[model samples]
Target: MLPVDTTQLLKGVLDLAVLAVLRDEDGYGYDILRRLRTSGLTEVGDASVYGTLRRLFNAGLLSTYVVPSVEGPHRKYYALNAAGRGELQRSGKIWQDFASTMDDLLRERETA
Candidate 1:
């Protein structure tokens, strides 16, 4: 099989990852990007993540509010609304199932 470009893979899952972050707590644009990087998703870009935040908010999956920050300007923070939380729960289950199936598909064949 050809090697998968991780950037391509990230595109499909970026929404879910963002939802995952917001599932735990609200965060601003840069904070979300930093969290993704800390979790070893180094390929994720700042603009892409910020764009996704706006898109998700537009789609009504996420809700936003402004809060004062110590370092920078009063930042827009994002959190999962009811719909967003629902999406996260559903996506989390889907990913868990997909991972299990892919693990089976990639395993070595047994020598009987």
Candidate 2:
């Protein structure tokens, strides 16, 4: 069997992952990327997370604000709006269902 490309899998679920992270609190681009890595998605890239934040904001699912930083430059934070929350819930359900199906399939193969 061939090894699974985690990067490819990350691409398929990057948006969902980003949304999930933002569900608890708002964060800047780099901070969001760090959260994903800390959550075991070390394969996630900076550009990908930043791009996802931009795309999500443009899609009307996220809101952004600028916060002045004492050390460096101002940070732009992203937060989920009503639409974003709705998308997160809907997407989460879809992911759960798909994951469950895949688990069942793998378990069957293991038993067989």
Candidate 2: global Cα-lDDT?
Answer: 0.95
Q: What is the lDDT of candidate 1?
A: 0.91
Cα-based lDDT at residue 29, candidate 2: 91
Please give the CA lDDT of all the candidate structures.
0.91, 0.95
| Per-residue C-alpha lDDT of model 1 across residues 1-112, encoded as one tens digit per residue | 9998999999989999999988888998989999998998999998899999999999999988999879978988898999999988999999999989887777744422
What TM-score does model 2 achieve against the real structure?
0.98
As for candidate 2, its clashing pairs are: none
Clashes of each: 0, 0
